[model samples]
Target: MSVTDKDRDILTRTLWGEARGEGLAGQIAVGWTIRNRVDDGKANSWWGESYAGVCQRPYQFSCWNKSDPNYAYLSGAKPIPPREFAQAQIAADQVMAGMVQDPTRGATHYYATSMPKPPVWVKGAKETLRLGHHIFFSDVP
Candidate 1:
């Protein structure tokens, strides 16, 4: 255990909550979006100050919301599936260590493909990449 142990753990859980069904590459893409926010080169970024902050930021990753089904598991009230969690950990480690290419191309925003329509913020945003069931975006401002 170390200073970033919790950060890594939260990031891993986030990957699992948000992209577990998408498999390794999907988790990695989601991880890079978080990493991009963390390294967005701004003091006190709106995205949040750290990995955990960004992941748990209100309304950002729906999984962390108390009402979301994944919240209990991420919060430890419920246990995550060992095998799926292990895959998320690998994706988190790769993104955290900068060991994988950013498939989203520095995207900081995304929406599930299942959404009936794109979120309003996407109106003027640049589409970056689309993989699995998520569509990535950048330059949201």
Candidate 2:
């Protein structure tokens, strides 16, 4: 699917909200996870139809959630720090353009290791990779 400018902006903001502190690799990993969701076919259409759709899909990535702590910054109500935003943009650009490898393998799911407990869905899923604070997974069935 073709990506529009709005899609790129939303994707970059999402990377900024979700993984900006984890640096470039972390941002790229998050981007790949969203792309994986987009490519996941009809089985996961609720994850959305494009980069923007996936990133903005309700309750999937919490940063876009209304109650999420990062909402203000991610939504532009509060500005992201310039350098961090730039780094996230770079990560988003590379991933969206298919210029980088899928560092999380084929992971379509992840949760920050910082979570008090792994989500129930993680059970029996194939563990993919750990990048920064998040643990990636796939093949949950």
Candidate 3:
């Protein structure tokens, strides 16, 4: 369960891609969601085994999806604005180092409120937190 340099970098990029516009609080929320997934203790987890894996897993975080506008910056094809990336890195490091409280409250999933419709999996699930433009859920199957 050790965090590596690559994990830190990927997690930083993920926060950048997924929540950069939402500011540091939003990025921290996203980071904790990924940390919850990484620490879920499920063997052969579909969510992936590490921070990098969870972030890079296809279709989980939209920024990694090829069609997302942030993909270019997240994938290094384009440079992230310096200040945004620096904030993302701080969020990633703090979350991974257990230096911050998890505002998501053990949430492993979330969706931006901007979605036209809520994703089906959130149906009947426990809503853990709402921050910025996202809604977070736990107890989702």
State TM-scores per candidate.
Answer: 0.96, 0.95, 0.97
Rank by TM-score, highest first.
3, 1, 2
TM-score top scorer: 3
Please write out the lDDT profile of model 1 over residues 15-124, one tens digit for every residue: 99999999999999999999998889898789888898889899899999999999999999999999999999999999998899999998999999898998999988
Per-residue lDDT of model 3, residues 89-134, tens digit only: 9999999998999999999999999999999998888999999899
Better of 2 and 3 by TM-score: 3
Misplaced by over 4 Å in model 3 are none
Which residue pairs in model 3 clash with each other?
none
What overall lDDT goes with each candidate model? Answer: 0.93, 0.91, 0.92
Ranking by lDDT: 1, 3, 2
